[model samples]
Target: MSKKILVILSEWGFWGEELVGPLEVLQSRNYKPVLCTPTGRRPRALPPSMDPGYKDPPLGKTVATPEMAEKVRRLDDPSNPYLANQRSLKAMLPERPYWSDLGELGYPDERGQMKMSYYPLRKWEGYCRARAQAQQALVEEFEALLLVGGSGPMIDLVNNYRVHDAILAFKQADKPIAAECYGVACLAKARNFDDPRSIIWGKHVTGHPQEYDYRDLAGVLDPETGAMLSREAGNPDRWVNFGPPFYTLEHILRDATGPEGGVHGSVGRPHSVIVDYPLITGRSTADSYTTGEKLVEVLEKGLRRYGW
Candidate 1:
């Protein structure tokens, strides 16, 4: 059946194959992809991902092909319709208000001059209702959510509550959720306010392993300004390393999956793609195509578990 997939990309940088692999597969079947970013800006592909000679440090193999590189260039082209229009997460999703001094959570202090905004019950009820409607609208409009991986997700997608809400919406609606590389961390972090535990707390998955992470050299985005250090300022190379990664995705997945669930890595295999019911995850860049195919299987073939 023809379907629409919600694709969340990192504005900072997204690995090229992560989007192309699954996208080509899904598009072949007439599936439509709706792309969005943390902000409204177009997503850029990591330069290393567009270089046919770029080899993964651990795997010792070239990760990007010439055809894949060209595809990334096409998608990145401003004239290309694929990314010309992008939905903004900030505009589309309702953000949960900070409660410490929101005035609704407690009796007004020195700063609480506005009486109209002090009704905690009313404020909460309104937020809950809006949140529910937003989630409902999201599920109704999209068949599934696919988060493309890159180091950039470490900067934006993982802890973004709006993204978490998007995940919760798909889960509530029983739609499949797929992520590759660092993008899988979102599944590990998406939790309910009441539960506190991750949605994938007991679900097997795969993501960027600690071993695959750079030990010293890493691409670090400036937290406040989104400006990354030079490949040599704002003028730096896209995938060039600046330091060490903030946190390892594999470590996060290991703790997130808990004891019952398992985390798989492609230590010896060419690719690692795990499907545990509603969630499908890929180990790293190499597994992009497989991750998309697995999502298709979940949506079309009724497959539930795979790559255990």
Candidate 2:
């Protein structure tokens, strides 16, 4: 039987190669990938990511090679086999409401202990439990899970509760979980229910570094009004209007991995990927292909250690 992998994409946008590179490796080896999104919508690619010749304003150059650029174009094409017949996340794992009705549960209040009655609170709790259970079952069908990255993931996947639960499921199963670029932030955020610590609380990993961060125009306000302009409209160059990244991936990963865990900043170097048992992380766009190949190794050969 063909190996199956569960692939999650951001609804906003995804870096083209982050999805295509690893996919090429998986498909070449006959590993079937199932695509999913937060709301079951077809994910889009960022404009800069789709154009091979487009100069990254921050990097002052184009990141895609002719060969990889073509791969991205093929994957984005509506006629692409992988995308054309893909299913939604909701379809793969049906989600139900937490509680149909509310009831009085004897629980402590902010002031003291009391029987609290509320709607949606208990239901929300139940929903989380059911959702987590469903995700665990869904993950069991696949050999591994992949979280593709881009600016979009910074918006959606970072704090997505569903994505966190899915990661937890994969971790529990001891299956490989791979992420690229900003997708690595999800790993730093995902934590077990009983523990407040992150999943990578003591693991070494790599992600987009400070050197890779863009010069955010959003950091500065209008000179006269002292008010920020509309991010999409106020700035034409797409640089001076939007706020800078709230957190650097490298710093966040360093903190999440704890003092014992290491955050490898492979910036200014060749492409890099790191494997720490069940977790595989890539630094940036350049690392996408290598990330995929490493994931394949982990799944096929049970690779436990790599690039430090």
RMSD of each: 4.7, 7.3
Model 1 C-alpha lDDT per residue in residues 1-308, reported as the tens digit of each score = 56799999888778888999989989987899889999777777777788888787766788888999888878766578777577998877766765443464422233433234555554555556667878999998899999999888988898999999999999989899999998999998999877978999889999887778877656644433445545555454454564667887888888998999889986777789999989999988889999989999999999899998
lDDT of 1 at 38: 90
Candidate achieving the largest lDDT: 1
Worst 10 residues of 2 by lDDT: 218-227
Q: What is the lDDT of residue 25 in candidate 2?
A: 85
Checking candidate 1 for backbone clashes, the offending pairs are: 218-242, 218-243, 230-233
TM-score of 2: 0.81
TM-score, predicted candidate 1 vs. hidden true structure: 0.89
Q: Positional deviation of 195 in candidate 2, in angstroms?
A: 1.3
Once superposed on the true structure, which residue ranges of model 1 sit more than 4 Å away at CA?
103-116, 119-121, 220-228, 231-242
Candidate 1 total steric clashes: 3
